[model samples]
Target chain A: MHIDTGSWHRYMALPAFLLFSLFFLFPLMQGAVLSFTDWDGFSTPSFIGFQNFVDFLHDARALQDVRTTVLFALGSAPLLNLCGLALALLLNKKFRGKQVVRALLYLPAVISPMIMGSIWYLLLQPKRGLFALLLQRVGVSGQGNWMLSSNLALVIIVLVNVWQYAGMTMVIYLAGLQAIPLEHYEAADIEGASSSQTFRHIVFPQLIPSLKINIITNIIGSLSVFEAILALTDGGPGYDTESLSIYILRMCYGNKTGYSTAVALMLFLIILIPVFISLRFFNKVEER
Target chain B: MKPNTTIVADARKTRLSPRNRLDWYLLAIVVLISCVAIIPFYLLVLLALKSPIGGLAAIRLMPDFHFVNFITAWQRSALGKAMFNSLVMTAGGVGLLVFLSSMAGYTIARFPGKLNRTIFTILLLCMMIPGIINTVPLYTLLIRLKGINTYWAMICVMAVNAMPFAIFLYSSFIRAMPVSLEESAIIDGCSWFEAFWRITFPLIGPVTSSVVILQGLGMWNNYAQAVFFLQDKAHRNIPLSISLFFQQYGADWPLMAAAAFLGLLPAVAAFLVFQRYFVEGITAGALKG
Candidate 1:
C-alpha cells in the first residue's frame, strides 16, 4: 500500500479551511479585540481596556435582559424536552398513517420561526385575534390581553417556542427510541414490568445520547432566543421581555458596538455554562 | 377438548376487549393533540382567505376562499424577487458547501495526520460557540470586503456557518464505507483526487442529500444574518421580505397572512418532497456524531 502522501488529495481541506477562517475564525478573533475598544460601528476604534465589560455589570437593562434570557431558557428547555419525549413515546407505537402524523407534528418546525411567531401573534392578538373573537362568541368579555403583561408575555413566548421546536426534539428522541432493540421490550414484558418501570429502567437509560443532544442544543437555542421574540413582542412592554441576543442587536445598532460585542461574548459564556454542566451530568449518567 | 377450547376463547376475549378500548383512547388523544398542533396554521389559512372588508373579526371556521389576497400579496410584497434571491443563495450555498465539505470530509476521514486532526478538532469546537459573538466583527468585515447584499458573500457566509456539521456528517459516512472502492480506482491509473471525484463522490449521494436537505433549509429560512446583510429590498430573502412586509402591513390581516403563506409554500413543498431524507439526515447527523 504505497499510496503517495504528497498529492492533491492532501490539500482537500484548503478551500473550506480558508473560507471558514476568513469568515468565521477571523471575525471571532477580531470580535474578541473589538469588545475592549470603543467602536461605534463607524469611525475609528480605540482601546478602552475592559470598560465595556465593566459597564455591562452596572447596566440595569443588560442585567434585566440576562434575567429574561435565563428565564426563557429555564422555561423553554425543560418543557421542550418533556413534551418531545412524551410525543416520541406517544407516536412510537405501530399504526397506520404514522408517518403522516409524524410529518404533521414536525411541520411547525420546518417553517421559519419568524413566520410561526407571526401566525401565533395573529391567532392571539389582543382583542381582535382569532382567540379573542372565539372568546367573544362564547360570551366571555372584558378580558385583558395577557400579552400586554410582562411575566405572562414571557410565559407565552416560552410556550410558543416549545410548540414550534418540540417536534425537532421529538424527532431526535424518536431516532433514539427506534434504535432500542425489540428484544428489550419483550424482555420487559416477560418480566411483567409496568410502562413507567420499563421507561425508567430500559428506555430512559438508552435515551441519554438523544437527551444530551436535545438538552445542549435547546439550552443554546433558548439562550440565544431572537427571531421569535422579535416577531412576537419585539421585546416590548418597555423592553421587559428583551433577550440578550436581541439586546445585543439593538445595542450594535444603537451606537454601542463595543458594548454589544462584549454582551455577545457574555451570552456565549452564559450558553457555555449550562452546556458544560449538562455534558458533565450526561457523562456521569452514561457512566452509571 | 371442548372445555379447553372454551377456556382459551375466554382468555382471548378478555385480552382483546381491553386492548381495543385502549387503542380507541390512544386514537382520540392523537387526533386531539394533532388538532392543537395544526390550529395556528389553520388560522393563518382562514385569515389569508378572508377579504379586507371584515378584518380579523370576520375570520371563521371555513375560509372565504377569496384567493385574490395571494395575488395582491405577490404584487405588493414583491415576493417573486425575494424567492429568486433565496433560491439563488440557497443553491449557491449548498453547492459550495457540498463541494468543499465533501472533499474535506474525505481527507479527514482517510487521513489521521496531525493537521487534519487539528482542523477537525477546531471545527467541532467552533460548532459550540455562539455565532452572535461574531456578528459585529463579521458585519464590519463584510462592509470592508463590499460583501453586504452580494450573493457570493452571503453564500460563503452561510456555507461557512454550516461547514462543521456537514463535514462531520460526510466524514462519519465515508469512514463507514469500504476503502477498497477508492483503492481500486486509484490502481486503475486514477490519482487519489480523480478517484475521489469519479468514484467516491458519486457513491456518497445519501450524505450529499442529507447535507443539502438539512443545511439548504436553514439557508432558505435564514433571517439573523440576512437582516444584517441584505438590508436592501432587492437582496431580501423570504424571511426578511416577509418580516418587513408584516411590519408595514400589520393592520392588514388578510394581506399579511397572504404574504406569510406565500413565503411558507416553497419550504412546505420541499419538506413534503424530501421529508424522508430530512428526518434521516437529522438522526444520522446527531446520533452518529
Candidate 2:
C-alpha cells in the first residue's frame, strides 16, 4: 500500500493550475484593468487614466451610495454578529423545545433575500400594510410608509440583512461554542464565576475566530447588497437604499457604464480595507 | 482560580432552583424572536387570497385561501420556462463546479506545499472579491463572447464564483482523509488520476453532497446574475421570472405571491431536507478562519 507523493502531485498540479489561471486569475486581472478604463462593451478602452477615480469621488450620487454602503456595513455587521452570538449562547444550554426553536430561528436564513424583499414591500406598504393597520388600531396613522423615506429605508434594509444572515452567524458561533472544551466551563463554575464574568473570560475569548469571519463577511455582503433592495424599491424613493452594487448595475446596464465602473472601483477599495483589517486582526488575536 | 464563598453559595442556589424569573424572561424573548421570523410567510399567504385592491385598501389578518391566484400567476408569467431554465442552469453549474473544484482540491491537498498554499490563498482572495466588483468587466466579456442570451454563460459564471468555496471544503475534507487508502490503490497499479477517482472521490462524498446542496440553493435562488446575463424573455430563469411577474402584475398581489411561492419551492425543499449538512458545510468554510 505504498506510493510516491511526487508523481501524484505532478499528475494533479497541471489541471489545477489551468483551472485557477482561467477562472481565478484571468477575470480578476481583467477586472482591475477595466476599473481604470472607460471601456464600453463594444470598443477598446480609451485609457482615461485616473479620470474615472476622480469622477467617482466628486459624483454626488456615487458618494451617497458610498455613505449608505458604509452605514449599512457598520450597522449590520456588529448587530448580526452580536445577535447571532447571543442566540448561540442562549441555545447552547440545556432546554426544552430547543431544536424547534433553533429551526424556527434559522428559517429566515434559507429564504431568498429577493423574495423576502417582495414580502416586506407588500407588508410594509404605506397606509395599507399590516404594520400600518396595526398602527392605526393603536391610534398611529402612517406607521407603514417607512421605506418611502431614504434613511428609514436604509435602516429597514439593514434589518432585513440581519434577519437573513444571523442564522448563518449563529450556526458558526454554535460550532465555536460547542468546540470550547467543557473543562473550561467546569473550571469557571468551580471558581464560582458569575455568568457575565464567565462569558467575558471564556466565551468571548473563544469566539474571536468566529466573530472575525462573521463580521468580515457581513461587512462585505452589506456593502454589495443589491437583490433585496432592487426587488424592494429598485433603489427608489430618491436612491436611498441604492448600494454600490445597485449603482454599478445602473451604470453597466443603465447606459452609465463609465459611471458604474467608477462606483465599482470605489466598492473594491471599500471592501479591500475591511478584508485587510480582518486578516490582520484575526492573525494577531489568534496568535495571542 | 480563586474560590469565592458567597458566589459559590449563590451559584448553588441558582443551580438547585428548577425555574427562575430570568429563565421565563429569556423564554419569552426567544418565542417573540421566533414569531418575528415566522409571521412574514404567513402574512404573504394571507395577502395572496384577498383581492389585491382590497388588500391595498386595508390589511387583512386572515388568509382568504385563494389558491387560484397561483394558477393565474403561473399562466400569465411564463413561469414554466423560467423553472426549466433555472433547473438546467443550476444542474449544469453544479456539475461543472464539482468537476473542476475536486480536481483542484485534490491537487492542493495531496501536494501540501508552497504552490498549493499559494493557489489556496488565491482562491480565498477570490472569495473576498465581491461579485459586483467585477460586473462591468464580466458583463463586457459576456457581451463580447455573445453569451448574454445563453444559459452556458450564466452557468460558467456561477461555477467560477462557486469554485473557491468548493475547493476549500473539498481540500479540507480530503486532507483529513487517510492517505493510506490512496497508497493502497496506487500499489494495486492504479494511476494517480485513477486513485483519486476510485479511492479519494468516494471518501469525499459527504462534503461533496453538502457543497451540492449549498450551491444548488444559491444557483436556484439567484436573481441578479440571471437578470444581468439573460436578456431574452424566453431565456430568463426563475428569479428573473419572479421579478418579471411583479412587473407584469404589479397590481395583482395574489398573482405575485403565487409566482414567488413557485420560485421559492425548490430551494425551500432542499433547505428542509439537507438543513443539518448545510449548517455543517457553512461552519467548515467560516471556522477555518
Candidate 3:
C-alpha cells in the first residue's frame, strides 16, 4: 500500500506542537529577549545589554550557589550511579521474593522528593530528631546540628538526593542487565575470564546505553536540584545551600526578574556544558 | 543415564553446597538493603501515628496508633480540597498529554515528513533545556492569559512539560510495530486519522499505559511548577498544600507527618498497583530514547 506523504495525517502533530510552542517555546523565546532587558517583574522595561550576566559573575551569592549546585551534582550523580549499579548487580540474580525486594528498594523514588525530605527532616532534626532521641535513650547528648553548617548541610542534601534517586538509576540499569543474553556470560565462563574482566569487557560496554541515559538524566536532575533542597534546607541558614534553580526562583519573586532570567539562562549554559561534554564523551566511547 | 546414581548424587552435593552458602549470604545482604531502603518510610509511619502530646522525644519504632492525626491533618490542611484539585489537574493533564502525544508520535513514526521530523527534533532539543528558565516569562504569560489558580492552566503546563518524553515513547513503540495493520485499514477506505484510531491506537495500549503511569505520577508529585502556578489555598495541589502545611505547623510534627502521608498515599497506591508498568515505561523510554 502506498502511503500518502502529504496527507492531513502529518498534521496529527499539530496540536501537541502548538500547545508546546504556546507554553514552552514562546516563553523560552520571550525569556531570551527579557534576559537583555530590565523588566523587574513590574517596572517598565529597558535594555541592559548583558549587565545582568555581568552582575551574576560578580554576585557573591550567585557564585556561591553555582558552587553549591555544581558541588551537589558532583557528589550526587556519581554516588547515584555507583549505588544504583551496585544494587542492580546485587539484585540481578534470581532469588526468593526478588520482586518484593526490588519493589521495596524502588519505593522511595516513587514518593515525592519533597515529602521524602520532610520525612528525613523529622528523623534528622538535631537534638529533637529521631536519631537524637535514640541517642538520648542510649544516654548520649549535646551533639551539634549538622544542618547548621553550610558544607555539612550541602553534603546531607547530596546524600539525600542520591538516596532518593538511586532506585531510579537501578531500575534502568537492571533493564540493561536483563537485556544481556545469557550466552554472553556462559561464553565468558568458558573463556575462564574473571568476573571483573568479564564485567569490564562484556557487561560495561553493553550497559553504555543505560549508562548514558542515567548519567545524563542524573546530571540534569542534580544540576537543577530544587524540591529536595527546598524541602530539606530551603537553601537555609542564610542561603548557604541555595542551588541555581532555587536562587533563580527567589530572584524571580524577589524583584530581580530580568536578572533572574539572565541567571536562568546562565544555568542553562552551566547545564549545557557538562551535558554536551558527557554526550560527546559517551559518543566517543560508544564508537570505540 | 541410570548407570551411576551414587556418583551423580555426590557430584550434585559438592557442586550445590558452596553455591547454596553463597546464595544465603546474598539473600542476607538483599534483605538488609531492603530494610535500609524501607526504614525511613517506617519512621514516617511512626511519626504520622505518634500523638502530638509526647512530641519527638517520645518517638519510637512502635507506633502509638494515634490515627487522629490523619483526621486532624485532613481537616486543618484542607487536604481534601487539595486532593480534589490534584485529582482534577492530574487527570486533565494526563488525558491531554496522552491524546496529543500519542497522535504526534504516531505521525512522526509513520510519516517522518519534513514537518514531523523537524517537530520531533525540536521537542528533543527542548527536553534538554531547563524549565526554570521559562519560569519568569511563563508566569507573566500565565497572568496575561489569567491562568493562575486555574485547573486548565496547570493541566496545559503539566501536559506540555511531559509531552516530549511521551511523544518519544510513543513514536519509538509505534516505529517498531509493522505498518501492515494500519496500512490494510487505510486501504480499506478508512482515512489515515480514522485508521490510526481504529487500527493503530488500540494496539499501542502498552505505550499509552506507560505514558500514563510515568507522567501521571510526575504530575501528581509535582512541586516545582505547582509551587509557582498553583499558589493560594484554594488552588493548592497535594505537594503545595503539604508544603504550606509544614511551614505553618512546623512544630507540630505529628500533624505535619500526617499531612505528608496523606499527600503521598495516592502516589504510593498508584505505584504499587502499576509498578510493573512504571519500570517498563522508564526502561523503554530511557533505553530507546
- In angstroms, give how far residue A285 of model 2 lies from its true place: 0.6
Greater lDDT among 2 and 3 belongs to: 3
Reference-based TM-score of each model:
0.95, 0.91, 0.95
Error of 2 at A147 (Å): 3.1
lDDT string, candidate 1, A1-288, tens digits: 886635668779878989999999999888888899988888899999989999999999999999999999999999999999999988887667779889988988889888888878777887888878878999997479777899999999999999998889999999999999877877776687877898999999999999999998899889989989988899988889999998887775677888888988899899888888998999998888
The Cα error of candidate 1 at residue B116, in Å, is 1.0
Candidate 2 Cα errors over 4 Å, as ranges: A1-20, A254-259, B1-22, B51-59, B113-115
Instruction: Say what the interface RMSD of candidate 3 is.
Output: 2.3
Q: Interface RMSD value for candidate 2, one decimal? A: 3.0
**The CA-based lDDT of model 1 is what?**
0.88
| Alpha-carbon DockQ of candidate 3 | 0.66
- Give the alpha carbon lDDT tens digit for every residue of B53-138 in model 3: 76677677789999999999999999999989989999999999999999999999998989999999999988888677788889
User: Against the unseen true structure, what C-alpha lDDT does each candidate score?
Assistant: 0.88, 0.77, 0.87
lDDT per residue as tens, model 1, B1-289: 9999999998765543321234877988889889988888888898889976666666779899999999999999999999999999999999999999999999999876888899999999887786666888898899999999899889999999999989988988899999998898877878888888999999998888888987898899888889988888899999999999999998888889899999999999988998898899878777875
DockQ of each: 0.62, 0.49, 0.66
Stretches of model 1 off by over 4 angstroms after superposition:
B1-22
| Pairs of colliding residues, candidate 1 | none
* Best-to-worst ranking by DockQ: 3, 1, 2
For every candidate, C-alpha RMSD to the true structure in Å: 2.9, 4.3, 2.4
